[model samples]
Each structure stands twice: as C-alpha cells, then as structure tokens.
Target: MSETVPNTTAPGRRSGGRVHRLALAGTLATVLGVSLVNGVTPAGAAEAPLSQSGKATASSSERGDLSAAAAIDGKENTRWSSAFSDPQWLQVDLGASKAIKKIVLKWENAYATAFTIQTSSGGGQWKTIHTTTAGKGGVQTLNVSATGRYVRLNTTRRSSQYGVSLWEFEVYGTGSGTATPRPSATPTTTPTTIPTKPAPTTATPPASGTNLPKGPVPPGAVRVAEFLAECPYTHRLPDDPIVMPGLSGGSHMHSFFGNTSTNADSDIKSLLKGGTTCSPKADLSSYWVPTLYSDDKPVEPTGTTFYYLGEGIKDELMAQTRPLPLGLRIVAGNAKATGVNDPTSSSRWSCLHAGEVGSSKNFVNCPAGKMLESYLDFPHCWNGKDLDSPDHKSHMSYPVNGACPASHPVIVPKLRQVLRYPVSGDPARFRLSSGPGYTMHADFFNAWPEAEMERRVRDCIRPIVKCGAGGTP
Candidate 1:
C-alpha cells in the first residue's frame, strides 16, 4: 500500500461563525422521525451551533468523534453501545456556528448506500441536503457549503450484501480567514506499493516526526510484512467463488456450499477489534494487490499498496457449486502445527486441506458405506470437532481424539491478514485538526475511554511509529 503523509498544512482561515452539524440517523425509529419531522434549513443560511443539552454534542473543529452525542444523535445500537450491531447512525456537531465549505464522509466498508445529509439550525428543523451512492471500499467525499448547528446523515439503504461499520468523518471550512496552510509536501505522484517480505534494513524513519503519518515507513513501525505474519486471525469468509475484478454486478452467491466472498473489505478492518484497520487495504486486496505486483515485489516505493480485489475462479460460477471434480485449492500456508496426531497443521501447505468425513449422510456423493471428503461440514464444527460435543470443552482444551473430524470443518481465520498492499506512490496528504495521534487525514482508530485509547496508542501505534524510524522495538 502507498505511504500516506498526514497533512501538516492547515487550511486558510475563513471568518464569520457559520453553523454546521453532522447527524447520524440509523434505522432508529425515534431518531429518524425526529430528524425528518424537524425539516432541515436550506444550505448556506446562517445557523447556530447546538446546545450541549441537545441530543448531539459539539466540537470546535468538525473532526468527528463517534462517541460524541452530536455524532450519533439518532442512531441506536451503534458501535459505541454495549449492544452494538451492524447499521448504526451518526451526526456531526460543529462546536459553534461557522460557514462550512466541504464535508468528507468515510465508511468502515461499503455498509451504507443512498445516504442523505441534511442541515438544521435548531434540532427540530431540517432540510434535504446531500445524497450519495456507496462503493465496497475506500472513502467518499461530498462537497457542500451550508451553515447550521446540526447536520444529519440518514441511510436510505444499508448494503445487505455486507453488514455495517464505520471509521471516521471530517468536515473542512472554506479558507477565507483563520485556517492557514502549512507547507506540506505536495500529494505524491505515485501510489504506495505492498511489500511481501520484511522491509530492507537500511530504510530510515520518515524525516517528519513519526507522530505525523508520512507514508508507509513511520518512525518505529515494523514493516507491513512483519505485522501480517504476527497478527492474530480475527475472522473469515465462506469458501465462495471470487468476484471477478471487472464484473460490475452481484453480491457473493453462496451456490458453492462452502465457498464465500472476500469482496467486502470490512472483514479485514475488524481485526483491530475496536480500532480501524492498520491501513485502508483491510479488504480489496484481491484486485489491488494483483495489479501492483510483479513476482511479489512492488512496482512503487511509497504508495502502490494493493487492495483486496474481487475474487475469480477462471471458470463458470456454478463450477464451485458441488464437490470438486478435481482436487481444489488446499491453502495451508498459515498452519501452526503438524502430524496426524498434532492438532495444528503445518503452515507450509498453501491450499485447502481435506480428509474423510466420518459419515456419508453429511455428503451427497459418499454413501454411508464409503469414506468421503467434502468441503461442507456437520453442525457446530470448530477445527473439525463438534463444538457442542461433551468432549469438546473449550477453545483452550484439545479434544480427547487428537484430530478433528473432517465433517466438522473449520477455516483458519484469514480475513484480517493484509494479503497485499494496494497503492504505490508518495504518501498522500491527510488533513487533520486534532486527536492525540491523528493530526492529519490518515487511517485512524475510533477512540475508546481515555485509558483504553492511551493503551492502544502506546502498545500499537507507537511501536509502528518506532519501526518506521529504523529503531529497535
């Protein structure tokens, strides 16, 4: 992936306090009703900032903090709630009334589509403001110059093809007055490239303080290759046929009983658990990585990081619907153990591994009389053993039988692995205003309580910074 330089340059300051608000409206009946009924004001009209007592909270800068009341006025079951589920909502509270220039909305993955942004001076009044279509990966930027204390975001549709999630939202003001541009290196000409092996030993820390994000080589961060190898498996997709990169339509079809789609990039982002993906390539590596690499080496130094491209099998989609006419891909590279008696398989095998299922009732072709091998599995299977079985006590305990039954199939979690870097070029400038580590518009995590956010910063972010600086961890 390409290295991104945080935007050190600030915007030229504009005068006159303009009101603006960003509201997240999920399917919450009460919140959506309140916003829709309020009727938003027209864009560009002078508006007032919201009160702290209102449903939304305020920030001097339009930098979005998901936890802020203003950011999630109408949404329920949000990422912040203990009952967090997919399809949440958020609102933006401009600390005070200020003329707004442009608004940037970022999605965790393409969880939302056909979303609308409305503006309101008082929480009760609203206006139909802006709308957008969604993509499976990357950021979507929308431009609007409106004044209001509150801005509301409502989703007409959440991509059922995928679930819900989000990373950040940012708003910029027109530079007529207070904001001043700092001299930042221009946006790089090349995109960042992904590296398969560990980074070379001689790379130096980025000249800018590692505190600032300026491309892939942060001050002390370990190379992406190292992080990928050591990271834990967070989740996985079904064994579906790969969505071909160029194909314009259709969600993952589960025709192949065991197959699944890795098309959704959000799958990779959740590996950070509460944080955003280490970088944007969490998914979309399928297409981005293939296009940028030649024999596994990158084509660019700073930016050419590949994203997970859609998947493809070089055959009709229906071919994967049944048992393999021929031996299928046996991915074994990430395995951790060995031997018929060993619970963990050797990681060297780079394809899907298979063995006999105990019974024919579970397989369409294999009769009860013969041993069978099918990708599908019996119920409650985890690492080949029935998780509900009496002998299957827990993840920490091994089954009395050394190996799991083939019918009880399990996939090693591969979704979170950074399969490839998607971009190649000089790091792009990420504009930022505040937040402990995020001063620019680079990939960042959603903050937790003060202590949790600080812990992650020290344990994760700081070390990555140090690695980029050519220092020992």
Candidate 2:
C-alpha cells in the first residue's frame, strides 16, 4: 500500500525547429523595437500561433480566476472553464488582422457539442468560417483560409454536465502587416456582446466558503454548520504519505501544513507526536498539496489551508457527521486530471476576492494584488467495514441527494479544504508541481485527539452552528 511510484507524465508539448526560430526571430525583433512582416510566415516556414499572445476573453467564465486566458496559454494542463450555458463564446485578437491558415481546438471532457468558428476583420460583426452541429470533444484540427484580426469559438450546446472547456485554442497562420502582438485585455466580467450564463450547476465543483456569512445563530441564517482548523504553511517536501508512502522524495514537491514532521513514512502515531501550525493546538492532522511554482521557483503558500467540516451534505446529515477517524487518510481532487472536465477531478480554482475574476478547473489569471485559491470537498460517506480501501478512496463516497451511498452508509464530516496561493497577474507564469491548477489535489492524515475531534463534530457541526478554532461559538 505504500511503495508505489505514481505516474507523472505530462501531455506532449508542441515544438519544432522552424517554430522555435520563428518565435526567436519575433522576440529579437520586439527587443530591437522593430516589426516582422506583419505576421506573415516566411516562405516554406510552418505557421505559428497568431492569437497575439494575450489573455483571452470569453462571453462568460465559471468564476473569477478561471479567466479565458487559460485556453490560449499553450499548456495542456491548463484550460478555460466556462459557466454552464448555451451560446457561450471565446475569442482572441491577433493584434491586427492576419492570414488565418488553421485553427486547432483542444477540448476537455466538457466540450462543445455544436459551435461556429467566427472571424472578424475590422468590423464589429463576426463572420463565420466554420460551423458544426455534431462536434466531438477532444482534439480537432480545422483547415481554413481567412483574413481577420479576431477569431472566436461560439459554442451553442454542451455534451457534458459542465460548460464547454478547452485546453488549447490555437490560431495558426502568418501576420499580415507590421502590427506588433499585444496582450489581450483581461476582463473580470463577461463580454457585453453576449448574455451572461446562469449560476453554475451542482455538477461544478463547489467553490470556497470565504464569503460565507457568520451568524451567531439567527433564524433563517445560512446554515453553514462547520468547525475549522486553519493550518498555516509548515514545510515543503517531495514526499506523500498517502500516495508514495515510505518512499521519501518519490513524489512531486508539496507544501505541507499542520503537523510539521510529516514525511513519506509518517503515520498517525508519528503525526500525533509532531508539532503543528494549526490554530487549534489539539489538531496534528497533516495536510498537503502539490507545491505551486512561479517562474520556475517554488512558492510557498502565504495563506493557510482551512479544514472545514459539515460543508457539502445536507444540514440534517450534520448529526451523522462523525469526526475523521485517526490515521484515516483521504485524498480530495485528482492530481492526474488531463483537463477541465476530468470526471475524477474535484478541484476548482478561483480568485481570492469576491467576484474579482472568473473561476475554472484549470489555472486562472487572477488580477494583480489578488491571490489564486482552490477548493475541494472530501468524500463524506464511509464504509464501516474498512478504515481505508485498496484504492485509498473506495471506502469513502460523496452523498447522493443528501443521503450517503448504501455501499458506504456511515456519514462522516464532509471535510472541505480551501487553499490559497500568493500569485497574481499572468496565469501562464504559474504551474503546480503536479501539472496545472486543475490537477491540484490535497491529502489529509487525521491525527487529532479523538476526544477533541468528537466534541467539535458533536457540538459545533451536529447542531448546525459555526464554531471557531476553540470549537465554540
């Protein structure tokens, strides 16, 4: 159960000698303050991405942070997750008009079942270049000839429960004139050209409870029955007790919180004896996530990861929400998610501030002065027979319609992890040690004293009351 080395292969990146040379030439020209043949690819040179290298803008975003820029960032692990709705559109400006040769769409699981490829030259009106009513999700390469400064994908129908998502939306061709590439204007709100989508559905991974109202106990208040453990950053390591147990440095880098002495070999016994950074002194639980990176340097979280209970299930289930069992390890979110719509993925990324930016299942372009955040809800239903399963997650399950699955009938406190990273500006500068934001995941090793854990669930959570670090109102 402990010595396996997890696979960490990243998607193949596109590269070519001619493309590199072209990109380098472009860079050198920019440094010298000169312009290349507008955007024209030289004779026999392969065409390059001509989207003006800017943050993308879409009709709408799922939440702040998941900006439209992700789709054009050229990283397969990152994607643009839109709000669930029909007639959503994503567009990019090429600085100035260009000769479009090919447009490639790399879709996640939640893909556009029907869409139109639109281009605009100098006018405000969009001109359709291609249309499809039976589009399949995955990688689609379209050959086309068009001259425009803007390209857009207007999705009209979705094939999955989630909104349309794309890992990459690439426009390949040559520049038309001496126009220099510019950063696309990143917007917080949806473009005014289209109607905003409705609120996200339950199918979307739940967002953070940062703005949750705190009520002493007024009637009709938001029934957010929860107790919290705010564990600040403790350390960084290349070990995972749950995934690569006993194999120190066998996994990717991780920023750990709570128990300070955790390592690949750590267990409940060792964690209990270790010191902690949690606000509540009794909590020695170990929590960790893949370390975030900015410009190739490891960045530790400036904010703590709050461990909350009684978050996802119905209020009535609070009474049955038992404290996490000692030594019980659980993982929330999928570190191996290939794209935004990976069914096993449960992580969501958003801007830290309220409505400051859109959210996504991939990396988000959080506005400057704001941090990026992630949310994940751990499975709350447990199989009484086993403390842990062979898969490490099969013993636990998320409730269905406020009821625990029969296969795992015992209800437990739904532990929701909210983690924040100190990063802003271009999301293209960010990447997790695992891959991207969508692959973000956290692991928990419960080591709290049985009595203290029990009291919090019994008094704070069960009664549908919010409790502070002390487990009291």
- For each candidate, C-alpha RMSD in Å? 23.3, 19.1
| lDDT of candidate 2 over 118-221, digit per residue (tens) | 99975688889999999976667788899888899999999865667776788877764432222222111101111122221111222322232222343211
lDDT tens string, model 1, 344-454? 221110001111111111112222222211111011113322212221112111111222234423211111112112221222211101111011011111112334323
Off by over 4 Å in 1: 1-87, 133-137, 161-163, 174-473
Task: Supply candidate 2's per-residue lDDT for 336.
Answer: 78
My TM-score estimates for the predictions, one after another, are 0.24, 0.55
